[model samples]
Target: MLSILDRYILKKYLGTFSLLLLLFIPIGITVHLAEKIDKILENEVPMTEVLIYLYNFTIYFANLLFPLFLFLSVIWFTSKLANNTEVVAFLSSGVSYYRFLRPYIIGATIVCAAALVFSMYLAPKASKGFNEFAFKYFNKGRSDRDQSNVYTQINDNDYIYVSYFNVTEKIGSNFTLEHFEGNKMTYKIAAGQIKFNDKDSTYTLFNYSKRKIGETNDILKTQHKLDTVFAFSMEDLTPVTYIAETLNFTELNDFIKKEKARGSSYINRYEVVRYKRWSLPVSAYILTVIAVAVSSVKRRGGMGVNLAIGISIGMVFIFFDKIFGTMAEQSSFSPFIATWFPNFVFGILAIYLLRNAKR
Candidate 1:
């Protein structure tokens, strides 16, 4: 079930979306680097380290820029269609507005799906390495790399605890493992110091002692060397304790669950980012509908007017998204809604305006 007009619109949809994202992401990175170049130079950062940090910043900025770039792409591309009278011609040729918009919807769906995959899977995986490089490369002070009270739970019933972990050195002290049986503690092992072996995905506890308070409260103690496998490896910790932007949706979800169960409040940022990663992808679809609805009306000022309004509205959406995200950290507003409220509200408004424009 397809038509020539559907194909035309699909071409425009994908062509514009891809072109804008490609163009704007580099522009964004350039602007970001230029602004920070002085600071980097003044700080006496090495050229290699500076470039690595810039790369990390650029990647994270690109992820955030996708929504705005997509919005602008739709607006400008559709304005061209309206300007050339192709839209009017389509209507005259018996193409209903919704029917004409179908290809756009399909294209938006593809973009949305791709966005989800990148944000939830690939991007996060990249972020892990990027963040580590950023920290290790640009750290001005040796003490800047220390981590505090790093605790994580690997499974529903199994837990891994590190009282004070040093991320810069990959060392943890006062480590403990407490196994649970529904609501009761069944096993407890306390270690003196833990070291992570990145190659084998295991933790080596040195000069450690343990006490097993279960089954009969039979206390067991040891010192010297203890080796064990941790549910999370060194790279996993980099995402949680170090950088919020580095984790994908699944990683964020698992991190929040772990920290929350461990009675840690520092995970609110990760929780918000988790919901945001899921919600941001559909923004492309919303922007497409809004762009078509706004531009097809043939305003008095033509394309320039439409572009200005489009950019303004897009900026407002970004502002609102940031505001709600901040409020999510400080208030009781549901983190899920806080991250996604702008997209949800704007999507509904776009539907209403699309109907009005057709009338």
Candidate 2:
């Protein structure tokens, strides 16, 4: 049922996209290595670890720049067709503009599906490994641990607050735990400082006091040092820097719900990541349409002019995405809006260009 022209265009579309990724990935790796070589040598990291880090970095970098690569590849190949007058020949043979676009749409759909899968699963795993290796081996001064004014809901009725927590030492100062029943406090424990003993898997609280609120009276007990076990652990207090990047779509949704309930300060940031996973996949289609429309017409300046325009548009798109993303992370802008704003704007532009190209 497939025609020769459809197959030809589809082949070119996918083949060029593949070739672009293959060529640029090594450049990305080399640049990254150049930036990190001094740190790697100074830290004296093992070759095995370096190899593993590079493997993970490959996945991370590819997923991060997939859209840019896709846009540029489409522009490159489509412009070549225009330069060769293949587009003119196809149109001269009575193929409608919409019909010619079908193969491109199908190709974009395939690539979009692959990108979705990568973002939801493989990229998360790679990001986790890559960031962990970076923080653990190369960047010794930086840590993934959250330390200041920590607050969270450990369970339905239990809440915790820590004024200061040192993740390296597994110690906390000015810690408070409260238990509530139907919005009424039942019991509370306040500690000047708490330390976790890894050997015994127990907590030691210094200058700790416990208060029990009864129906009639309150009973308070004070102790110099108390050793006990709690439902939570040190790991709960210290979360990774890119925790959102480590979870798949389902896990990210559940995490956002829980974090929202706990009034996390970084909820907006997590929501931005969640929305972006879906947005980037949709962008593949929009960018593909734009690329086809822009490069369909053979210009006086030929491929160079088309590529220059494509690169400028690509840069502008990235700039808009970064600005809106930062706004969502820092301000009250909805993550859903921030994540999709560039797509919405560019999608309209694609439609306009497609209309003009059709005429």
Candidate 3:
């Protein structure tokens, strides 16, 4: 039961967006492949893995730049409509400006839903593969985890520290574990070096010593080498920096809960990722409105002028998003505020522009 005008405009909106993605994704892949081909050749990476990496990279790249694609696509087609005086004809035919905007809103909703799905599920899977391949082949010898001066609370009464950890080797120097009971030290374990045995799921401590506190005296035990099991996993020592990006919505929530319980210092970073998953999809509507308003008025300079304006606005939006996101991740800034501030600012802009366009 859709009107002809609604069908026409909706078709144009979705068709233009789809065409933009089809055109740009291949260019992105070509550019990426060109930049990384040398490394791929040197590493002798298999063709099968390379193809899989490209597939993941496409999703990662698309998700990262979806808003820009959407904005530009809207501007492109809307400008074309304005240049052809289609908008003027529609408005003259007793269609109010708001009525004229119906199809665009419908298109935005569709895109927003798809974006939500991508962020919640598809993007995380792609991110895991994308980051894993980059770290494994392109960034060998570099770690995605903090390998120096590691400290963490594994559970309520247990804390561990290491001066330096080798993520690849699963080894550490200057390892110490402390147990406390009601603000009193219960026992402490220290070792000059520690190595995890993956096969046995145990730790081997060199120059190991343990001190047990008593009401009157402290009992000390020392050994040249000791093998034992602890209440923590090796992953608890140093989770990869991108660990938050690899988990889907539910998994991410569960992970953040566990990390919060463990007193993780990277909670802000994780929360930033969590908030962005929702924020990015919402921005689609704001950006769509802005794009239509900016491009719906025919200009003397034609479509190029609208495109210039769109690109500048897009760049500023991305800049604000990255700057605030980084601040939230690195500082005590609220992740919710950081993630949504750009959208809030741009939404106000969208309102102002829409009002002007109506005039």
Candidate 4:
């Protein structure tokens, strides 16, 4: 808690991290400007708008590589110290290699925990504003990406069949509600359209008809020409809160609950994303441990060589992560494995490297 060496190492790691971000952001801006100059000019977008949008989008790129940046920074700085024999000096001066690891672990713990909060508590809410701002002014807003077909469900029971739903225009078409207490259909309602009134928490149907069956092969039919209201929420269609990347953990969980009650089919993606968010943050700690361990030891190679290796490893990790996630989304792999396998593998590797660093 009070060692100067620990502080020094923490200072080095954080200082380099800050410097990398500061430098990379401006470079990112320049690159974005050069790439988007044509569209910005052609769309007659304001320079200020372009600047603002690009600034927000910069976070997207920076976040994707933040761990790599942190890891490389540790490798770069610590490797330099090792190559200069400072590590040997420390070792000679009553400091064990394991003792020197204290600062790295401490710093990594803080960073990883902070990253977890950022991804789970902050990122989506921020992205909502960021995306709106980008779309409204910078990129010219478009219709929402989520679309769904209508389904017939009694009180959102989802035991019946529905054809499709229109999000832009609040309407459900070819709706059929089937009631089955056990293995038989006790009732069925086929409606032409379902109209939703969100503010009032109700819905209206147009050109609707209902059919009922009783024991002894008795049947009853009913029809309605005018509009009628029933409790309905547009959320039943797409369940915005459970769309994985769109909502943070708390909100997503709430959405999952609501949709689960309705017997939604796509809940797996949301759960996978929630678990992955926690796993990814932990990965930052694992990567940091490996980076510091590899660099903290005195070696014949310098910072450049170690940094190159670190960056390469980090890129490969990121690639496999994306690949596995895609495969999971496509139902080619188990969601649990796809989401956390890379982190699990790398975490083991980090432990091995840290052991060697002690030797």
Candidate 5:
């Protein structure tokens, strides 16, 4: 059903991409191991855990740079074809530039689908393992979540606050919970300290006191210690900064919905993660078009010139992505725009370059 030219280019596209992954992933692992080996040894981390961490780190690293790798692979192989005059011969024949682009589009489709799967499921699992191991070993005494002055609305009528929370221990100090009926406060509970029991899904509050507000007077009750159930979990106090990254597509959607209801300060951060899952994969098509257009013309500067140009473009794209992503996370910038802006700008570039290549 396919022509020989299509098959040949498609084979080259996928093979080169695979080769780049194999080449770079090891270097990434080696660098990461070199940096963390001292901490790993000092912590006495198990060899099995270290191996698993590396496995997770591979997926995490690959997912983070998938688009760049794909972009470079397309440039590398297409530049080679241009250097050999194969692309020139095909275009000089009866084949149109669009016809020549067909295999690249097919290759982009394959990569896009695979990338979607990775972002939706595999990458989240790897992120959870990778970040958990880092926090447990490499970042001891430091937390990956906001741990001070945490406030959350558990429901329409219930709100909770904690002065300080310990994520590792699932404990909080200066905890308070308030219940409201319409505009009036119904009751409030305060605790000197609180600990969550994971086994029983309960909470232990030390030096607990409850105040029930009335029209005339307030009734107060006190206890040295109390074990009670609350509608909220320990995560409600202060979820990790990367919690959104560790959830799969379905879970992320659900989490965003809940966080929205709770008026979370990190909503933009979560939304950025959500939008990137789709945007990153879609960039494959735009980058592929740009790569082919950049490399299909034979130049005196040769493949090196094409690669240099490609790497520069790749670095710029990554720069735009990281800057905008950080702005969205740290400020009130629109996450949708931040996530898609790089792709949109480069898509325009792809079109312009593609027109020139056709000419």
Candidate 6:
């Protein structure tokens, strides 16, 4: 039992969003292709591989810039309604402003659900495929090791450190592992170089030395070659930039838990990604409210003026998101705060504008 007005607004909202996505995605693909064409030709990549890359890129780009497109679409269609005086007619017909906003909320909910699904499942797969394709074909000689000066907690009693690690070869230099009991160091192992044997699932330590601490004295052992097993694996030593983007919501949470346990320095960046997945969907509701409030009032300059305003606001929002995201990744800023601060600030603005629009 839906009202005619509700159906009309809902249709316009969803239809406009679809149209905008279709219109802009090709332009995005074209620009991306133009930039990457030289790399494709230089690498002598096949057309079939290029097509698959573009397919994955489509999903990646759409999910990446979802909010901007949604904001512009809302502004475009709502401004059209305002220019036609449809909003005024509806208001004059005894529909309160809050009631008039219902269809917008409904429409946003639908889009938000879709966004959540995309981010949780589809986007991760697309991101993995896209990054893998780019790295395999375009980024020749690029190393996979994401960081230097790596430190990790192997377990409750063991810790490890590596001055540098090579992900391509599964090797590390200047490696140290320490085992502690309460406040006392029980034993320590050091190696000049360590290589992981994937077939054997063990480490080969060159120039290895071990120290066993005792109450009265310490015993030391030295060897030129040593093979041993640890609680961790090569994946633990080499973290990739795209690792967070490849995991779904459930996998992401588990990853965060494991990384936290391991005292990973990259945990901040991973947490930011986790928070943003949910925040992206929630922002759909916030942006829809702000969009309607901004574009519902008819202006002398027409749709172009409204679009200008919408684009300006969209740019500001994106700027804030990037700044805060960088802070979370580089500094000690909490990822939750960084992710939600933009929403809180913009939500207040939405409320202010909605009150003004009501009057």
Best by lDDT: 5
TM-score of 3: 0.97
TM-score of each: 0.72, 0.95, 0.97, 0.82, 0.93, 0.97
lDDT of 2: 0.91
> Which digits, one per residue and each the tens of the lDDT, describe model 1 over residues 252-328?
67767766775554566667878878788888888889988998767778899999999988999999899999988
What are the runs in model 4 whose C-alpha is more than 4 Å off? 33-64, 132-143, 148-162, 180-184, 192-207, 218-226, 240-243, 297-301, 332-334
Instruction: Supply the TM-score for candidate 1.
Output: 0.72
Residue 338, model 4: lDDT of 86
Q: Write the per-residue lDDT of candidate 3 for residues 1-359, one digit (tens) a residue.
A: 67999999999999999999999999999999999999999999999999999999999989989999999999999999999999999999999999989999999999999999999999999999999999999998899788888888899899899999998899999999999997988999999999999998999999999999999999999999999999888888877899999999999999999889878889999999999999998998999999999999999999999999999999999999999999999999999999999999999999999999999
Off by over 4 Å in 3: none
- Candidate 2 colliding pairs: none
Candidate number that wins on lDDT, 3 or 4:
3
lDDT of 4 by residue, 102-181 (tens): 88888888778877777886666555655665444445544343444533233543354446666666777776667776
lDDT (Cα, tens digit) per residue for candidate 5, span 1-359: 77999999999999999999999999999999999999999999999999999999999989989999999999999999999999989988999999999999999999999999999999999999999999999999989889999988899888899999987788899999999998888999999999999999999999999999989999999999999999987778887889999999999999999989887888999999999999999999999999999999898999999999999999999999999999999999999999999999999999999999999
After best superposition, candidate 1 residue 19: deviation in angstroms?
1.9
Model 4 gets an lDDT of 0.71
Best by TM-score: 3
lDDT of 2 by residue, 263-300 (tens): 67788889999998999989999999999999999999
Worst 10 residues of 3 by lDDT: 231-240
Which of the predicted structures, 1 or 5, would earn the higher TM-score when compared with the native? 5
What residue runs in model 5 are displaced by over 4 Å at the alpha carbon? 168-170, 197-207, 216-227
**lDDT against true structure, model 3:** 0.95
Off by over 4 Å in 2: 214-217
Could you give candidate 6's per-residue lDDT for residues 1-359 as a string of tens digits? 66999999999999999999999999999999999999999999989989989999999989978988999999999999999999999999999999999999999999999999999999999899899988887787885456478788878788888899987788899999999998799999999999999998999999999999999999999999999998888877777778999999999999999888878888899999999999988999889999999999999999999999999999999999999999999999999999999999999999999999899
lDDT of each: 0.76, 0.91, 0.95, 0.71, 0.95, 0.92
